[model samples]
Target: MKRVEGRVALVTGAAQGIGLAVAQRLKEEGAIVVMSDLNAAALQEAARRLDADAIVQDVASEQGWIDTMRSIREAHGALHILVNNAGIEGDPSAPKDPQGAPLTDWNKIFTVNSAGVFLACKHAITLMSESGGGSIVNVSSIASLVPTPFLTAYGAAKASVQHLTQSVALHCATSGYRIRCNSVHPGQARTPMLEALFERMARQAGASVEQFTAAFVAQIPMGSLQEPEDVANLVLFLASDEARYITGQAIACDGGYVLAH
Candidate 1:
């Protein structure tokens, strides 16, 4: 039997990159996938290509979470898997350190990255408990594990996600909801977001993008950047029955980058 056949799964930020990869993997595993993204145009096209459902959603809005849950309840009546992959890295051009980054950037990053995951977990747990429980895989970052002097706000927000994920997991486990929540920490993924960050950082350092990328890869013990599908594979495992015993943990899919870093 397919791992998640007949299961209803929702992936946020599914327009591209890791989100898109996770959506595709779930669909391939026989899940009934619902893809959501703030970018309506890209989401529609991606959903069309995957023959999946799409919801244009802003993850940072409380009303958006309410509407999203309502839509899921109406459409599927059950949500077996939720991938909270929506997040922002803040303005790359701005200073990102604690001493230099603006309060506005910090607020915006936390609103979306931290608070967004919290809201998603809040609403999802309710429906999931009502619909027979589910799994939540929050896409955090390696930034949460280590210091991020150049991306302070983003790191702090992701650390919030990590903590909240554990709290939610424990809450459901104790409440007999059967819901599992965990966070996945990815490192230096080769996504459009990372590419943009690399370009900006390279320019800031007056170095070629290739040189910057090479320096990054050199830090990774595996000597390469991870692809979106790499992280998606781990998510698939967690979302499936195979990881039924696993909960309240933060796993990294960084090709050993976290280890060396």
Candidate 2:
């Protein structure tokens, strides 16, 4: 059976990795998918691959969210699912820098990672609330739960996201919005983003990618990194009616990374 058939869904940062996987999965389940990302080339490529709508948007920009929702309202009439997946690590090399994190880095990271989700929720909630409500899944990270001094800014920002998820969920539930808000915390997933991350971490540690990956994988009790589909499946489940009773919770897609560590 189709889980979310005929639903109009929107996914941000859908050009690749987890966002792309969620978009693809939703479409496969018969939802009309709309994807947004700042990268024109990658977004275009992924849109073609999924035969889904593409909107170039900067999630941190309030105006961008406004315009995006306006366009969605015009094109799709209503939005049934919203995946706030647009986020950035913004130079994970802070551990190598003796000066620590700069103010600009902190602002940029939180703006896109934390405030972006807030902005999306602010606008999308109105749309969903007026149209019988829907589900919202924020793509957070296990770093939020695990203490990562190397990823100090990212961890802090995502922790804020986790708290924000609970607040949004509770508000919507109490206000009778019928909207479900949740955060999905992914572990080290196998994606281009993971490759870039390992490359940076290896450079910082003065080790090869193979050595770095081996050490990282050994840390996870599951013995491997998570795949994009692994994260996508959980997201799809949460978005579908099967999870109608679940909200205001942070679910992990990590392959036991947070549990082991």
Best by lDDT: 1
For all candidates, the clash counts are 0, 0
lDDT of 2: 0.91
Off by over 4 Å in 1: none
lDDT of 1 by residue, 114-135 (tens): 9999999988888888878889
lDDT tens readout by residue for model 2, 1-261: 899999999999999999999999999999999999999999999999999999999999999999999999999899989999888888664542324778788888899999999999999999988878889999999989988777777888999999999999999999999999999999988888889889988987899999999999998988988889999999999999999999989999877888877
Per-residue error (Å), model 2, residue 73: 0.3
- For all the candidates, what are their Cα RMSDs to the real structure? 0.7, 1.4
